[model samples]
Target chain A: MIISIVGAGALGKTYGGLLAQQHEVHYLMRSEYAQVKREGGFTLVFPPPQNSMQIEAPLLHQDAKTLPPSDLVIISTKTTANHELGALLGHCIKENTLVLVIQNGIGNEEWISQLVPHNPLICGVSSMKATRLENNTVEIAYIAELRLAPFQAATEKQCEIIEQAFAATSPAIPVKAYQSYKEIRWRKLIWNVPFSALSIIYQQDTQVLATRQPYVSIVRALMNEVADIAKADGVTISQEHMAKMLEATQKSGPYYPSMYFDSIQGKPIEKEYIIDNVLALARQYHIETPMLNLIQTNLN
Target chain B: MIISIVGAGALGKTYGGLLAQQHEVHYLMRSEYAQVKREGGFTLVFPPPQNSMQIEAPLLHQDAKTLPPSDLVIISTKTTANHELGALLGHCIKENTLVLVIQNGIGNEEWISQLVPHNPLICGVSSMKATRLENNTVEIAYIAELRLAPFQAATEKQCEIIEQAFAATSPAIPVKAYQSYKEIRWRKLIWNVPFSALSIIYQQDTQVLATRQPYVSIVRALMNEVADIAKADGVTISQEHMAKMLEATQKSGPYYPSMYFDSIQGKPIEKEYIIDNVLALARQYHIETPMLNLIQTNLN
Candidate 1:
């Protein structure tokens, strides 16, 4: 399958580099046009070669304007950058391009659906700890199960092809196809909301964060609240899974979450996106949410 | 009045040296039997003498084994060393000795009472931050209220005499006699449980701890839980007072709490005493105290 992975920086280059090894992977670059149009295409440092995957100028284009429409368009960009990625996807997408959004934060699926209304939108939450080391490299420090939540009712053959494309590029990374995607998305949302948002609010390392009694308690309370909202929204999320989410965060402590990175960079925070989403949902359900509410209010 | 002050620390010496100018003040040292004994008398450094108090030794002895029993024994030992002080208090008291506990932490009433079981015990809490300089000099940091919880409903004249003793020594400090001592102790207990314990737990400076969302939340939750326990125990702890308790700790940022001092020294942490008291009370009331229980289980 001809795969044009859009917005190729860190996560973009991550998916692009890995998939490119076994398939035709086209990397859509941003404004640094001349730098990429020459040589040294998406420099990826994959495992074995994984420490750094330096793709020596694999068929690179500067923008969607330069690229041909493809079968699968994996939009791997920042949640804030999703709209631009979506607009580009709309311009270059074939009639039935499976746009799998492998990004953090909430509402990327709906964000793309609104822009490219005809494109099949699937929101997949990736738990890979990938840190970008300049444009030339990204380190995939850790890998967890990657889930592609069901968006529209697509064919089994289409699903297989999409899965195969991702699998071929990164065979080690599992892409589970969820029949009920909201359940998985919200479950993933439960983990992201507290860990990412709280990490930003405290401006502390994740390892030190786990040791703080208050932060841990708040995280647990927020997860419980998220579970309540999920149950109210008719999504089945178990307590054991909630505990697992916290445990996963504990294991991922040495690695900084994206929200914390965003905070340090003085960029616009995701307080409104991650926490506000759950709070808005809680309000819709008329749930009492002082814990999550206060955490929301304190986010910068 | 023939006044003998034990524990010749800052506050002890401050009051002792002041009263020596007018009334009888004896600086009861633990051991002067081995040398360094002088009848030069306790020198109270003053605004009169280059701004330093040099109190000559009045009376020096080690424990109950030495010295004659006096009318009153003013105990000013550190609360962490309260057990040892309590043992000394038991060994040295005369028939009519009145012991005033000038220390922090909850259960001072019963704690000291357990050691010196039949003596007239005055459970008092002080907000005076005292720092002892060289020799006998001391600096008073803040002038806050001092509450003396009634030992056994002393007569008006007895109360007046105790008041007069304090007035003669420290004119700047105000001592309030509380009809109910448990209420006052619980109020102070609320402050230490969250801020001090958290300071030790997080090893964070006051400014970061004061406003950090999780720290503040843990603090508020601990206060709220303690307040609920107080309510269940029929203590009139208001939300207004609760806010004030938090405000005081938050305002005093960058200050190393005494508990933090104890933690660094590898001494027995005081959360077992301060917070443990509240959690026990909560257990009695069947109160749902997630925060206190969480903190208690952590450091222990």
Candidate 2:
């Protein structure tokens, strides 16, 4: 199966390189395409020492109109860049193309779905952590399950084809399919709302959020608020998941979330989906969210 | 009438100098006793250039076993020092001395009352703003009414003596007596909790709080929470007062509340009284104050 990964960030590079092991995988790069082409490809330091290897994944430029359409095109960009990427996806998509958006926040799938009109939309939330160590290399620091949910009803053969492409990789990243895509996104928000938003506000990393009493209490309140918002949206987020998120943050050590790094680097944040989306939903549900509202106000 | 002003910080110096205009006032100094004595006294720059005057408030050392007794002793110090000051008040209180604590926060009156069990207790909440500048001088930038309320019932003559002492000053700092001392303190907390707590949290001043959107929203939410807590405590903090507080902060310009300055300077904060007292009351009233509670946790 032919696969292409859009938005050449760390997440895109990591997954694309892994899939390139068994089948043809293309990376659509805007800025680094020339450098990667000249160098024949980039390298990926997969998790564990021995798994590291050089990857000669093919690179695709945005200007190439005659490029071959792939069976699957993964949109793995920051949520802030989703609008532009969506427009770009329209130019390359085929009738049966399965477009998967592995991004943070809510309402992203709907936006991408509208941009690419007829293509089947599959949304993904990955726990696998990766970093682009240099201009031509990415390091997969941790590999966890990658969950996928189709926004529209997907036939069994289409689902199997998607799963087979992932399973064929030399060391395939785990994938789990969900029935309700909205529930998956809302559940993901339980962690993202507090960790992403607060990491930026406090200008600290996950370790500090876990260890500090004040931050811990605040993070707890924020998580509970998000859960409340989710429950109002007809998705019941369990207390067990909230506690798991807190514990995971503590165990993750001193890693900065993407939002924190984005803020420190002076990039535009994805507040629209992460914070504003919840606020919009809360307003619709007539629920008061003073805690989330205060945080959102500060982040703004 | 002879009077002594304990805690020789700017707040104490400002009021002590004003009283020294028409009566003898002594200032009890902990660290600057020798310096103040060598300089004869510190100057008081009262509001409006024409009202500014030199003040020769007599200095007293806390170690002096035979300290002068006075008709009234105004305890004006940071709440952080209240514990030690409460112990020290026993050393200087006369049998009939009227003790007026011109301080911030709620529990100082109770603490002092415990130390001097029988003396008439009058609590004064001053809105006059002053700063001790370099070179041993204090500048009274803004003059507002000083509200005085008795903790225990005192004779009319006792109240008159306290009020007259303030009125006799050259450019008298206005003083108003209140019937309910607890109400006055809670009303003051409505302003102090948000400005003081947030100023410390954001590490910014009043101007930032006034101008910034999310911060302004947050400040408003915090103010409302305090008002809610106040209502639970049976003190009706009006919406008018809330608006007035917001307007005051905006008009106050770029001033750092004491708590913010303290946090920046690495000094111990007065969170125990400023934040904890409210939380305790909230707990008692079965009121949830996630906003104030979060700020308090962060400050801790």
Candidate 3:
């Protein structure tokens, strides 16, 4: 099996390492493009590693043109870089190869659907938390069995093969799948809309947002917008269940969302993916989203 | 005429210096009790002090017991520290002394009234921003002219004499007699609740709060709460007029409110005085103040 990763960030390296155990893995990193292959491979510090989660130094390549196509081409780039990387993978991907997008926020499915249409494209809702310690040391903060589902309603045998591919990596890494991935993704969307926007607005963590009413109000309102979008898109989220998720946010203690981490690094934010998509969809579906509109304007 | 000073912080020192020009002044400062006398006489550095602005350093005493009946006494302490100082002034004050509390926040007139009943008191509002430089120099940030009204609605020549005494020294500190000091106090109350709460909440200045949406919403909500309290208390506040005040918040850019300054020092905040007062009054008057309640709870 050949697994080509479209991102070189924390989640990209982690999943690539997991799949690399049984497959020939490749990475498309931003910095040190040449050094990745010069050093023989990329290193990812995983959870089990001592003092660091240094993952396997799998076969790495920056250019999509040089990669061998096989089992799957996973787009694990940040939401901001998804489209550009989608184009990069579009040029090299073969007809039979499936595409899986595992990134934060919405619109990754739409971005890759344009490139991977008619092929199996999996939408992943990853609960695992990860951070990159320097370039190659990708620290997996927490691991949770991922829920995988088809981007479209087509639950074909190809999707089952994709699940089996993830299962095969379990011996050397950890991977799992769920049939109810649509529900799970919508739930995760609920968390993302609130946490990411509130963190960016207050320049604080979930804990701080939970404690401050203005941030909490803003977070709740934005989450309602996402949940509204989800329902309008045919996924139901009850208010009581939503309140439970808000309660769970306090358990993360003081976790900074990935978008906030991006902000601290002075990197270009995924405002277009996180905020822009929800707002555009809300407009399309005629959803009332004053709170989301305010957040969207703020992001701009 | 001898003037006794209480709570010798910035405003206390500024007004103490202003009144000391024509009268023998006694400032009761805590800490360094001996140094107040040993410095020969305290020094007030009023840079570019002209246009009727004056500075005078008179006989200083640390304990309130060193004071006899004076023509006037000004309270210029941080609102959080007022409880202790108010009790101290209650125990060692002559009935004939006119104690004018030139401070921020509402409930000061009532707070002092409980301490010294039947005593002539002047309630004042001074928009003088002060910053203590290296514990030696206190620079006046601004003086939008000071206003003085009777603590209670009184027609005696007493208010005029107190204003005249202050004007004789500073010569430019205007003291307007309001038919009701509560109206003037509530108007000043508008300046504080939003600026202090928003600035302290975001840990930023007026300009930053005015510019951002999250902050802008929080500030607008807080202003609406204050305006409601003012209206319930018999003061009319138009929506357009209230909006202008928020715009002026940016105009008063970069100035750190006293509450924000106190938060920086880890001192107890006057969250109780500003927001809490508005909220309590609202509750008493049956005016709904959801935003003020949120800010008050967060601050506490």
Report residue B126 deviation for candidate 2 (angstroms): 1.0
lDDT, model 3, position B65 = 66
Candidate 1 lDDT over residue span A30-128, tens digit each = 754467666566565555634555677776776687677877788876666654664576556878877777876556666677776777777677777
lDDT of 2 by residue, B224-251 (tens): 8788888987789888889987887888
- The alpha-carbon deviation from the true structure for residue B154 of candidate 2, after best TM-score superposition, in angstroms, is 2.9
Poorest stretch of ten by lDDT in candidate 2 chain A: A59-68
- What DockQ do you compute for every candidate structure? 0.02, 0.04, 0.03
DockQ, structure candidate 1? 0.02
Clash totals for all candidate models: 21, 0, 7
Per-residue lDDT tens digits for candidate 1, residues B1-300, read: 556676766667666666666666555565332332544543444333235555565555555555356666677766656667645664457766677777666665667767666667777777666665444346666656777776643333455566776665544456677777777777877776777776776687655666666567667788888888878877778889888766766678567767787789787666645777677778889887655655664556
Best by lDDT: 2
Alpha-carbon runs more than 4 Å astray in model 3: A1-300, B32-38, B45-57, B153-156
Q: Chain B of model 1: TM-score?
A: 0.82
lDDT of 2 by residue, A1-300 (tens): 577788878888878877777757777787777878888888878766547778764656655353458778888878888767745675457888878889888888878877777788888898778877666888778777887787754544565566777777767767878777778888888888888887887677878877775577678777777888788878898899889878978987898877887788899888988899888988889776656866876776
lDDT of 2 at A274: 86
